[model samples]
Target chain A: MLKITNLHANIEDKEILKGINLEINPGEVHAIMGPNGSGKSTLSSVIAGKEEYEMTEGEIIFEGGDLTELDPEERSHKGIFLSFQYPVEIPGVSVTNFMKASLNAHRKANGQEDMPANEMLKMIREKSELLEMDRKFLSRSLNQGFSGGEKKRNEIFQMAMLNPKLAILDETDSGLDIDALKIVANGVNKLKSKDNAVLVITHYQRLLDYIVPDFVHVMLDGKIVKSGTKELAYELEERGYDWIKQEQL
Target chain B: MELKDKLISSFLAFEEAFDVDSDIHEVRSNAIKEFESLGFPSKKEEDWKYTSLNTVLKHDYSVFPKKEDALEYRDIKKYLIHDIDTYKLVFIDGIYSSHLSETTHDKIDVCLMSSALSKSKYKPIIDAYFNKIVPKNGLNSLNTAFSKEGAFIHIHKNKLADKPIQIVNFSTGNESALMVQPRNLIVVDENSQAQIIERHQSLTDHPVFTNSVTEIFAGKRAIVDYYKIQNDRASASLIDNTFVEQQEESVCSMHTFSFGGKLTRNNLNFYQRGERCDSTMKGITIIEDKQHVDHNTLVHHIFPNCESHQDYKGIFDENSTGVFNGKVLVEKEAQKINAFQSNNNILLDDKATINSKPQLEIFADDVKCSHGCTIGQLDEESLFYLRARGIPLKEARALLMYAFANNVLESVRIPELKKRITSQIALKLGVSLGFDL
Candidate 1:
């Protein structure tokens, strides 16, 4: 469902992601473990079409179409979702309103009529319950004054609402407690399907235990150094990225 | 007569007709002389640098007479409150229209200044507070010098009114340039509470100007919520000044929503005189297509332990201009005062402009005061977030702008007024943001 060939990106002349090659098929989960400043987040951001990063080299293909040329919204309409490392707090915009706008935008892009308000409300209620989010949270301003765990769960709730084809979870488990991590993982697990893919990017291997991945890639110094099965995540977590750095050297 | 000559003649006519008494006639005359000295400010004036009042000043305008045009109550029935059983006051062309107004509460007295001019019971209150806070300079003095008729509302001591009072001021023209000055004085006595909604509208599409001044006094422990809605015609020019004075432990909240006008200026001043007094001022202006809106707010904390907050936002599109100047003053004795002021604006077009200045003048130590202003466009990330969800770009922009202005509208306490303003704001966003409603 996704392909990257020597993807090189940078911000303001500083190279972040250099020659990153990865491939993911449908119904598969991939975990990218990297140390700090190792371009793990940059790779996800470049794929999500964040304009801050300049693509210096290479290309990305999503679902057989060139993804590098698409705008962020277009990529989003193509079912690409990025759970931000730090969710933005948009004041005065309610969660339900934000979700409805996003969903309707995607539908409009795909030439579909907007979902009826009643149906949307029902869907939100069901998904919010699944994510263990209070209905009142939907009425409050989007992510304003929300706790870290609540924000992560809200991101998962939005993912469930949009039902993207590719869900990229970036540090979703960083600020979450054990209960929140399980709830978020459970939400992701429920949304897993044969035609969709999940990319979990994390610094710790604990998140991998809840949402087991089919493949794990160790990233160091702006490049993916090794690719293996889920066992690699445990190995890296036990021994730390210092061993990976030595191997790269 | 030439344009300038006609303007001078109009000023002289107002100066001749003004009823100046012994106590304040000197002050009023001095104000009139000052008005004559300064004349109508052109674009050259520092304060009128961005806003050109030449259209209003150069026009051969006449004042609307008190009994010239007869308008019925049904002409403005759409804006009246049918559900709430309360006092209704009507003013046409700045003159109090007794035929269109109705009052129910005995303790709450609502009467026209014309009637009060003849009666003795409310004469002292009217004389004491009328045109008291409006300074003798520039547009305010001109308004006072040319003022014709208005309403006087006095809530008796300790009288808790059951329903909010509604004031609807309408300006009508007969295909000629005309000016209407509506002066109001509202005094809420000790331990009293009330809500007032002041609505201004135009009866004709022709060019009409309304210069209004309202002075409010909230007594000890009194609470008052004042809302001003300006939805005039595109050809109308509005200059509204509202001054609120709070006594010991009194609370005052003012919300001004400016949605239409060729050029509109709102001056809101709050004086926190007594200890533990609280004041909040919020306003939102949505201007498009050559329109200009200016909001100047000042919150003065004179006593100790007073708190004040001011938030104003503007959305300008299609060569429109918005100006916001918010000032918070904490006196030397006003220690432990908490004052915050913020003004933010969004410019949707390259030609659209916004000038926001937050001024903090604190003379006391151990006071918390902060003021800041932000001028920018819509967030690109948030826009992308919405568009990615399948909402079109136009709808997404409108939604974001609506959310931006919703911060101010949510502070309105009256549900009906809040909903009405919200729908109006939505319509404005739809029109300005190019989204189909």
Candidate 2:
């Protein structure tokens, strides 16, 4: 469903992603495990078309089209979703309204009319209920004064509402508690279909236990060094990332 | 001839047309003398440093419109809060339009300023509160010298106004260049309540200059809410001077919304005379193109235990410019005063400019006064976040700007008025935000 060829990204004078390439097929779950400053987040951001990062020498093909020339919104309309590590707080926009706008934007891009008011409300109620979100949570300003758990849950909630073709979870497990982790994982698992894919980027294997990945890739420096099955995640969790560097050397 | 000299010469004709034998002649003569001495405020003055009036002043504005042009309600209904029942004091080319007005004297006085200033029955109220708190500023003096007609509202003691009052002045553009000075007087008796909405609109593209003055007197325990809507065409310029007086336990608040205009200058001042008075001044200015808006405010706490709040926000796009000068003064005897002033601005493009200055002078040893000012661009990460959610770039920006300016509407006591302001903001941002609650 997604392809990255010779992805070389840079921010300003420094090169972040030296040379990286990865592919994820539909109906499969892929996990990229890396340490701090290993370009894990940069890869996710570049795939999502962040303007600050310069794609020095790379072409991202999503759904058989080049995403390098597409804007973030255009990529979004083409079914790409990025769950941010730190969500921005918009003081006056309610989460429910935000969801409605997002959903309608995608519809508009496809030359479709906005979802009916009652249908939109029903979808919001169903999605928020699935994520164990309080109805009151949908009325408050978007991410304003929300707890860490609530912010992460809200991100997952947006992912569910948009239902994009490719879901990139960047550090989604950073601020989630055990209960929130379970709920988030359950939500992601339910939304996963044969036509869509999920890419989980994290440093810990704790989340992999919930939403087990089909393939595990160990990323170091700026490239993928090793590829293994789900068992590789458990082994790395036990031995730590230093073992990967030793094995590479 | 120069606009200033033209206005001075026109004062004689204005006096000859109006009641020269009336009691307000002395006041008018003195005000014209002040305008003659001060001329028009220049950029050399500290108060007018960031704003220049040279372009708007060069127009040979007809000091008095030659004819009173009639307008159909349907043509101008869009400019008013027409959804609700309001006491409308409508003016066409600075002349009172009786057919378009709904003035009343039942329990509360929602009428015209000409009647209040000329009728003997209202002489007592006029003699007591007419221009009592107005200061001697150049534009203010010009407004006073030519003060003729506007809305005059009076709520009886312990009475509540039946409905909101709307004062709208429409320039017909019948003349080549028209100038109007609308004088408004609002006096709420002790323990009364009132809400007033004022707007200045130009019907055509002809250049219209309006110098307006409003004086609001809030008696003891009275509550007064005032709204000024400055949404005019690029061919229109406005100068508004509003003075408010609050007594013991009274509350007076004014909110100015400037969405479109060539140039607009608001000189708003408040004086707290008794203890525990609450004064609020808030504004939101969103102007694109070469439009300009200036907000100059002052809150003087003369009595002890008084409180004042000021929150002004602006969004300047394209080549628009904005200025905010807010001052809070606490007298020596005014102990335990709480005065807070905050000014925040966002410049969308590089050419857009905003000059914000928050001044606080505290003479009392025991007072809490804080002022803050910020000018910057929208958050890039926030923009990216919204864009990533499938919202287009323009819609994302408009949403953010709407969110930034929505909090000021929270204090609007009327639901219909709040909704009107909300939609007006969306219109200004060029987006139908659909902020339905």
Q: TM-score of chain B only, all predictions?
A: 0.91, 0.98
Candidates' DockQ values? 0.34, 0.68
TM-score of chain A of 1: 0.99
Candidate lDDT (C-alpha), each: 0.82, 0.91
Candidate 1 CA-lDDT value: 0.82
Among residues 3 or more apart in sequence or in different chains, the pairs in candidate 1 whose N, CA or C atoms overlap within 3 Å are A102-B389, A104-B390, A104-B391, A105-B390, A105-B391, A106-B389, A106-B390, A106-B391, A107-B390
Model 2: lDDT of residue B52: 95
TM-scores for every predicted model: 0.90, 0.98
Task: Report lDDT (Cα) of residue B229, candidate 2.
Answer: 90
TM-score for candidate 1, residues paired by index: 0.90
lDDT of 1 by residue, A154-218 (tens): 99999999899999999999999999999999999999999999999999999999999999999
Ten residues in a row with the worst lDDT in model 1 chain A? A100-109
Per-prediction fnat: 0.41, 0.77
Candidate 2 regions exceeding 4 Å error are B432-437
